[model samples]
Target: MTRKTKPSTAAAVQMPLKEAEAGKETNCDEDKPSDHPKERDNNVKDNDGTKPAAEWKLPRKKALLQFRCKLEDAIRGDYLLGRSYWSLSRLSRENMSSASSQPLPLMDIRLWGVPLLPSKGHEGTDYVLTKFLKARNYKVGEAFEMLQETLWWRRQHRVDETTGEAPLGPDELVLRTMYVRSVDREGRPLCYHVYGALEDREVYKRALGTKERVEEFKSWAVQFMERVARRLSFKDGGVDSVVQITDLKNMRSRSAKEARGVLRSTFLMVQDHYPELVHRHIILNVPLWYYTFHLLLLRLLHQSDKSKFILARPAKVTKTLLKFIDPEDLPVEYGGLLRENDEEFSNLDKVSEVFVGGNTTKSIRIPIAEAGSTVVWDLTVVGWDVSYKEEFMPEDEGSYRVTLNRSKKLRESVRNSYYINEPGELVITVRNPTFKKKRVLYRTKFKPTVPMYVFFKS
Candidate 1:
């Protein structure tokens, strides 16, 4: 299901002369049917270009036959050309995968004697083209078009437009071709396309001076980069190809270029300004949470101003979270704060004071990474598990620890233990202990010293 926008006027377009020079001759009757067509009565020139109109006139049936033949031949040629699309794509993928540490093969990138913009000096171009396509495995617009057309055709036949009826059969979508275009950031025109996938977003955005579009692409790209950074831990791929569209003969003034340059710079400047948006693609059976650390990681990655950095840290999620800050580097006060708030240090039976009274009671204000499976806490104890607490003892002003003994009747079970940072997301999760054979078990719990709604009296 893809909806591709139309290409800009500047996108690459192959004119007849260029096509001819490339050995893509227009001599075939399928391409130049009028060149050799039996002349019409209106004094059209025949193949020999010497026939008079009266001699050239042919019956309508003959004209129809010639058109049919031409169409058939055209279809055959189109089929061969279309098939080459898949072959070229496969070749591209293979070459990218095998590209050495030396650099992308520049000579192989030329088209009809005109060389492609090199990726050597412009590192961003290589990263954008190779890595992005490698991740997606390029989509063929021809196939997409066929699917879209088929679906539309079926939809047209199955539904009663006036009555608002249901479709009679399974709906399908098809797409055939895509139009491509290239424009400079300043709206300077470059190339055009008849059949191709949507231009790479980063490349298009950078070239077109589309701030919003560039940000959208950067956000998506950053997430992808983060995933690759974490999982594959590969240093090879970064920003790839950069395609430029400009007036070839210096038709534009220096001011024009400068003006566009400002807009392009501003767009890149704000690329990482927003938090990442990660979401589950489908309904889920269990609770799940997503926390993005790309911004933090990027900052750390850039701090050194070096070309290479080795991540020797373990890959476990908890370990990764712990690696966020070097324990030794933490300030004494902040270290104490972390230790004080640390779940391991807090006693389960205590009402923990998470925030101090001040102008802002916003300590530990992390956004809710997950909204499913509401955490349940024992009112009498503050802990993840609270099955057997026998007694509660206060350790500090707003903290308590509980001793648990299931056999003792002196303790009371605590209920309503956990609170969610975000509401309205609990429906997606199963309650704790619902699926596991092991019964609910816990020793202690804790709560805030000053409940959020409570105002401190002077």
Candidate 2:
């Protein structure tokens, strides 16, 4: 029921040495909202005076239809399905019937749970087929070949059967370094490839130490992808791809070189085996040479592959990510409100936004009239270069005001709590000293608790 295929690179690669995390993070996708942020002008030359490749766009209807028709014909004659190969997993040849034993006329053909037969009339069939076609630039011949190889690779490696931690035997930490964290603004799964985690020499060695280790990690990458795939809905108008946010801070050149074998092969596997599955590949905290490296990639990678990539240097890391992800879903490290193992808030908490214009001040007040209540708040001033402080203002002016935090400069998000014993308002003040506007995301909640006596019943 399975076959294996060895992948051959059809293009040059510039994979991150820390993880299988390249090729994601752009809002220019076909199904993205019309209000998607504007992309940088590709024609605009960088300081090196060289222009990057044209921005990727969905193929025209005529070309798409033409390629789809040709692909249908090829699939009809493929040996995998009654010589038509409407699928790689064909129905059993013997028909189960009480009257006669003629073979079943229908072949139950499918890929990733989506029926591949053009005749099957599955709503997602076109969407899935176009992915392969686009990966190969609308070349029916190449797309068909890629599909065949992808199915064989899945079968040979038993990819769909991949499960649990490090299925192919990579270090445990290797699995932790990359995985789905949450969904993006559009509901596509948001995955973080924290290459920074690999800076640990032991972790790096265990993952990319030898040829065998590299292959093991490659298998781990494939298995990791299967988990991400399970989260997707491969139907018309469904979220069928993932957004990759790769953090490359502290990645050493030596480590990168050591990881090149795994990185390159893993990148190639994603390209060949899971085309169009990456919605955006956002590279964060890139070093100085990232521009030059990316320029070379723009020239080498196919339009479909290169277009998903977005790079953000240390300073721009937050701003760049906020464009494609919502403030709530994005991790706090990237200037969003998200926190690991956070007990104070959930996605339903509803973060509110405010703007503090340059040389201006803004204030947020949360009224808590209930006595013996605790107030917890999470706040962030994007691109922070501001001074801020919070205070407990008592409704009874005679009771006096308490300064919770003294005014100070901040460069990151904030999470704090205060107990309120009386009716008053928790006031937060932000002063934007810079010459540019600052956007703030803030949320507050009230907590309930009981005396220790409540736990006494055994």
| Candidate No. with top lDDT | 2
> Tens-digit lDDT track for model 1 on 348-440?
133222312222211122222443323433222111121223322332445433333232221232333334433321111112212222112
Candidate 2: tens digits of C-alpha lDDT, residues 1-458? 67776422111011110111233332224332221122222232111122211222334333445544554554555553334432323432222233332222223445665655554344455557667866776676677778878866776676644544444344457557777776766667787767777788987777777878777777777877767765566542356677877787887665687554554565567777888787777888887655665675566567667767887888888788888777888888889998988888987688899999999999898888777778899999889899999999999989989899999998889999987788999999999999999888999988875545558967
* lDDT scores of the candidates, listed in order: 0.24, 0.67
Distance from true position, residue 167, model 2, in Å? 5.0
Model 2 lDDT, full chain set: 0.67
Task: Provide the clashing-pair count of each candidate structure.
Answer: 48, 8
Query: Candidate 2: misplaced stretches above 4 Å?
Result: 1-109, 118-122, 161-171, 448-458
Which RMSD values do the candidates have, in order?
Answer: 28.1, 12.3
- How close is every model to the real structure, measured as TM-score? 0.16, 0.74
Candidate 1 wrong stretches, greater than 4 Å? 1-83, 86-320, 323-402, 405-458
Best by TM-score: 2
